[model samples]
Target: MDFDEAGKSLSLEKDEYIELVEFFFPAAEIDINKLMTANEKGDTELASDAAHSLKGAAGNLGFMELSDLARSIEERARNAQVTGLSLKIKELKDKIAIIEEAFEKHKNS
Candidate 1:
């Protein structure tokens, strides 16, 4: 992710950018976790809700990859398509790892 670009587009200072990212980190993590659990249980509504939340949060933070994956999962879950839900969930989880790594690097820096 382009941290500098995102911060500039959002009109945030460095510290403010980090703070905003920090605030969103856990929410996105939790929602992704919930999405997986909901998928496992065939809970379409729950999964869709979690995916929707993750999609918005990821997009807001300029995590475009995550945002796009979350959107795919959201639409699939809403449509009750469980055929490839696990794979989609796995992809979303992988994208979450990217943000987690970025957040860790930001914290360490």
Candidate 2:
């Protein structure tokens, strides 16, 4: 994700960007956790719904990699392709960690 482009396009000042990201972080985390839980329980519909929501939210916040991974997870879950969902969920979690680290760095900067 090119946050520079997103920042400029959104006219996001340092504080404003931080605030926006912070606002979404909790919900994103919760949705991801819920999605994982749903997947574990074999609730494909709920898992897909959560993943889809997370994808849109992450995309809106410029977490492009995370968004893409979430979208893939959602699609695969919707199609009942459970074989790779765990791997994809792990990837999504890793991306989320990256986003969190980036946000912390930006906050300190």
Candidate 3:
């Protein structure tokens, strides 16, 4: 939740970085849903696509934790390995929720 560091990496003001982060949340949630659905359907290729998209987006925004999680999922999917993906997806969701909560606290402060 180092917004200052993230803003520096992106060359954005704090408020601008926050704006992008706010925009990313819902879109990321959609991607997560797509990943979950794809996983349940055993669509590894589709899941990989979703995970790759999320990794790229998160990495670009300096959210490395999210990017790394997504990358792991992507790699597993690319290998056609669907084992324990539900647990990984849940972990990703938990991280996202924690980040969102921190962001809300930042807003209030």
Higher-lDDT candidate of 1 and 3? 3
- Summarize candidate 1's per-residue lDDT along 1-109 as a digit string, tens digits: 6686888888889789888888887887799789888988889999999999989988987888889888998998899998898998888887777767977886687
Clash count, one per candidate: 0, 0, 0
Ranking by lDDT: 3, 1, 2
Error of 2 at 73 (Å): 0.5
CA error at residue 76 for candidate 1, angstroms: 0.3
Off by over 4 Å in 1: 106-109
The per-residue C-alpha lDDT of model 2 at residue 36 equals: 88
**lDDT (0 to 1) per candidate:** 0.86, 0.84, 0.92
Which is the leading candidate under lDDT?
Answer: 3
Error of 1 at 37 (Å): 1.5
**Residue-wise C-alpha lDDT for candidate 3, range 9-64, written one tens digit per residue:** 89999889989999989989999999999999999999999999999988989989
Taking all chains together, the TM-score of candidate 1 against the true structure is 0.90
Q: Stretches of candidate 3 above 4 Å error? A: none
Off by over 4 Å in 2: 1-4
